[model samples]
Target: MSALLDEIFDVAGSVVLVTGAGSGIGRTIAETLAACGATVIGADRDEDRLGEIKDTQGVEPVHLDVADAGAVDNVVNSIVENHGRLDVVFANAGIARGGGLTTPQGTIDAFDLTAWHELLDVNVHGVVHTVRAAARPMKRQASGSIVVTASTAGLRADPLVSYSYVVAKAGVVNLVRQAALDLARWQVRVNAIAPGPFKTNIGGGGPIDPAVEARWGSTVALGRMGETRELRGLALLLASNASSFMTGCVYPVDGGALLQSLSLDPAE
Candidate 1:
């Protein structure tokens, strides 16, 4: 039974890359992969967060800004050159700014263009860069997995997040599908993990206000926000052979958040 389980979930010795490894879901994914015996290259623009995991047994930290296309290519090339192959990639770097339609700033008429562009540069373009760069080597190898970090917001509208955040995530959801179709011919799988409101630093890195947490939690059937650790099992499954037949799928780890309907009014 153990041997069979190992065979189904084996990821040991695989060369993996995870962007946005500094904190939140990305950090959890990177650490989980490394702990499972994959040679993980944890990349992030923040040197401090990278430093936090530098000494982790199977993780190698590197500076990376996924928004920069050239930098992304260079990093992927360097990884391939050093590791000889990239078996898995988590194109998970993203940022959130401004407010959703609930707030005055979030309304369409008052939305900040500068904030929108800045978020899109990192959230949308960054994912594109990572996927494009990773696809090259994966196609050459003819066997690799690309997991994108999408959001429940992408799957549907939500008033809790900013306009840019929703737009970027929604765009990537389709990107994952299109990329999956294009890369399937090469046996390189592409998928997206659309998470609900997990407690993470995506909203400017600090403790979440209890009232705000409760508000977000109310939208979930489980009635609570998810911890980063809760994502490990699915992350591992998608990265490993356990999900061999799964491709172009968008798996949501939302604790039934999608089952509930959200109100446009923040007070509701």
Candidate 2:
């Protein structure tokens, strides 16, 4: 077993591109891969954030909005041109905005046009454009891994977060499955991570409400919110040869939160 992991999970020399690599899970993934010996290219719309990350971990940084069709393709092209090939593409860029019909201030309400567009643009269209760009090269290479970041809300509806957040994440999950099937013949693996409430900035900006977070933790079988590092092993597993036979599957790393019926404010 130990020998198998040593051989199968070796990421050395692989070229990986991680979108939204400026912060949170994307950042974690990039740094982890670098430490594990993969050549990582990190992309983000925030130039300064990208620069900061670049300075720290020696990642090649490219600035572009994932929603922009031309920019998306350009980023992919840049990676191929510079690295010769991209072995892993993690489309983990996403945003969250919460609102119900009654809350005119909510992100999905008609009044929140900018927020709604931002959510759809970054969360849905971004993933679409990104994966579309990656598919071709991965197909030609006949081997690659694509991991998408979805949410627990994607599996079921709840009032804990914004409506659009749930919808966008759900769409991402389906996209992973569909892409997985389409790329199977090419030996390109596509999978999604249905991460539960982690100490990240997606739904909650930075600091989660203590009470709300406590409530969510209570509902989880693990009795705590997940650490970002806990996901590193899982990410490497799916991206490496360990999961050569796994694709078109959504792995929920939610500490079993999806198993509980109790509703906690997911936004926290």
Candidate 3:
């Protein structure tokens, strides 16, 4: 049983790159992969956060801004040059700014263009940069796994998140599909992990108010927000050979958040 499990889920020695490794879901994924024996390149723009995990075994911390196409390309290319191959990439760097419909600032008429552009640059364009960069080496090797961090908001309309976030995630969901099809011939796979409300620093990185936490938790069927650690099993599955037959798929680790309807009643 142990050997069979290892054979199916083995990720040892796989060279991996995870963006946004400074905090939240990205950090969890990076740590999990590294612990599983994968040589992980954990990249983030926040040097401070990167410092937190710099000493983690099997993880190499690097400063990276996914929004910069050239920088992203450089990082990916350098990884391939140094490691000989990039077996997996987690394009998980993203930010949530501005307001959603629930807030007065989030209303369509009051939408903040500056925030929209800023968020999209990192959320949408950043994914594009990472995917494009990772695709090159993966195509050459003809075998690789690219897992993107999309949001459950992208899969449906949620008033709790910002307009920019929804648009960015929705856009990436299709982007994953298109990229998956394009990369299929080379035996490379692309997929998205549509996370629901997980306790992460994406929303300002501060401690959550108990009431607010409860509110977010109420949106999911499980009546709780997920911990970053909860994402590990699925993250590993997608990054490893366990999901060899999966591609262009969007799997939600939202604790059944999509199972219920979100009431728009502000008073509730």
Q: Quote the lDDT for 170 in model 1.
A: 97
What does each candidate score in C-alpha RMSD? 0.8, 2.6, 0.8
Tens-digit lDDT string for candidate 1 (1-268):
9999888889999999999998999999999999889999999999989999899889999999999999999999999999999999999999999998778899888999999999999999999999999999999999999999999999998898888999999999999999999999999999999999999998888899999999898999999999999999999999998888899999999999999999986676
lDDT of 3 by residue, 99-138 (tens): 8778889987898999999999999999999999999999
Please list the C-alpha lDDT of all candidates, in the order they appear: 0.94, 0.85, 0.93
> What TM-score number comes out for model 2?
0.91
Number of clashes recorded per candidate: 0, 1, 0
* lDDT for residue 198 in candidate 2, whole number 0-100: 83
Candidate 2 residue lDDT tens string, 104-171: 55444354666777898999999999899999899999999999988887998755666778789899
| Candidate 3 error regions (>4 Å) | none
Worst 10 residues of 2 by lDDT: 100-109
Candidate 2 local Cα displacement, residue 197, angstroms = 0.2
* Candidate 2 lDDT: 0.85
